[model samples]
Target: MDLVGKVAYITGGSKGIGYGVAKKLLQAGMKVAISGRTLETVQQAAEKLGKTDKVLAIASDVSKHGDEKKAVAQILAKWGTLDVVLANAGVGHFAPIDEMSDAQWHAMINTNLNGVFHTLKASVEALKKSKGYYISLASLAGTNFFANGAGYNATKFGVVGFTQAAMLDLRQYDIKVSTIMPGSVATHFNDHEPSPEDAWKIQPEDIGDLVLNLLHMNPRTLPSKIEVRPTRPDKK
Candidate 1:
């Protein structure tokens, strides 16, 4: 697909993986729209990308269907078409299931699971019109279970399942769907600061490049699920 002039919407794009994807798409000549719950951060991210003309910054809460709907509408209003949708907004809460609060559990479920649902639901019609692509950023936790990961694991697992089923359901319309499961990415997720020691892990731009590769693939071929991790872990 010719990326030039194509439009893409990315949720949680103010930082981390989503921001990296936005930068890559813009560099590929796509008109990119990035959303954050905070207007200031979204604007800052757009400015950082340094493509005011090609970038649209929207303040949107992916957990809310209304916000997603408005965001899609805004993107269509500005670009007149939508070609890609990246449901990348997610949160993680680690606690024993017994000790987890309702807020913690709900936050993960709402943003990680229902958030993807809302973003896709709001954009499906536009995607059908453009025969676009949809990708969700899941996590290694989606498949591998661990202690203190009940909430995060549930949501990521749900994301993987939902995206796979969505792939089947949307393919008839030529709207490709896929989920990327990445391990130990270097980002500010979970409110942790990235340090030089994290360089060995997956970089945000690596995921960006992965998304670019997927977009360029032949429409007849679909890699419905991808699992990626670092080749070399940080030595103890």
Candidate 2:
């Protein structure tokens, strides 16, 4: 696909991986719309990104289908066409299954698993119309289970399965789907601050670069699922 002038929508794009991907898309000359839970935060992020003519910020909570529908409507209204959708809004709550609270478990399920569905459901028609791409931000935990990560793991696993199945279902319409599973990114997830000490971990722009690669890949090839990790994890 010719990325120039194409339209892409990213959930949870206020910062971190989403922000990095948005930057790359803008650099590639694609118009981008970024949605977050709060309008002010999304608007602030758009200002920080500094491509006023190419950026649109929307207040949206992926866990809620209504918000996602409204978000897609706004994107269509502004861009008239949607070529890419990234279901990147997610929340993590790590705890032993025995110790995890209902609130924490449900939070992960709603935002991480169900949220991807909501994003896709709201935008699939536009994708079909454009023969576009849909990518989900899952995690390594989706396949590799670990201690103190039961809730997070379950949600990510569901995301991977859902995305893979959706790929098969959507391919008939020429809409591409894939899931990205990454390990230990330096981001503000789970309240952790990214710092220079995180040098050993994958950086946000690295994932952004991967997304750009996926977008540029030929349609004859589909990298349905990708697992990415830090090159030198032992450095930590």
Candidate 3:
């Protein structure tokens, strides 16, 4: 697809993978809208991205349907049409099931799972109009469970299932859907700070490259589920 002028929306785009992907899409000549829970942060990112006509910043909480609906409406108002949606907003609260607080579990479910559904619901009609693409940022934990990760695991697993099922349901409309599961990405997720010592982990731009590849893939081919990992996890 020719990316010039094509408009894309990314949730949780203030930093990390979402921000990284926004940079890549803009570089490829696409107009990009990035949203976060805070307006100041998203605006700062948009300013850093430059191309004032091509970058839009929105304040949205993806877990809320109304917020996501308002966000999509703003995107349509600015760009006239939406060509892509990236459900990248997520949170992690790791603890043994017996010890995990109700707040932590619900936070994961509400943001990681319900957030994706809300984002897609708000954007699906616009996608049908453009026959566009929907991509979610899941994690390897979706498939591989580990101790103290039950809540996080359940939400990501739901995301993978949700995206795959949505792909089947949307294909007839020419709307493409896919989920990307990445391992050990270097980002400020769950309050972990990134530094030079984290070079061995997958960088956010690596995931951006994958998104670009998927966007440029043959229209007839649908890579609905992708599992990506660092080439050498043992290096560190």
TM-score of 2: 0.98
Better of 1 and 2 by TM-score: 1
Residue 203 shift from truth in candidate 1, angstroms:
0.4
lDDT of 1 by residue, 66-148 (tens): 99999999999998999999999999889899999999999999999999999999999999999999999999999999999
lDDT of 2 by residue, 1-236 (tens): 89999999999999999998999899999999999999999999999999899999999999999999999999999989999999999898887889999999999999999999999999999999999999999999999999999999999999999999999999999999999999989999989999989999998889889999999999999999999999988452
Ranking by lDDT: 1, 3, 2
Q: List per-prediction Cα lDDT, in the order shown.
A: 0.96, 0.95, 0.96
Can you write out model 3's per-residue Cα lDDT over 59-109, one digit (the tens) per residue? 999989999999999999988999999999999999899999999999999
Q: Which stretches of candidate 2 lie over 4 Å from their true place?
A: 234-236
Best by TM-score: 1
Superposed on all Cα atoms, model 3 deviates from the true structure by an RMSD in Å of 0.8
Give the root-mean-square deviation of each candidate in angstroms. Answer: 0.6, 0.8, 0.8
Off by over 4 Å in 1: none
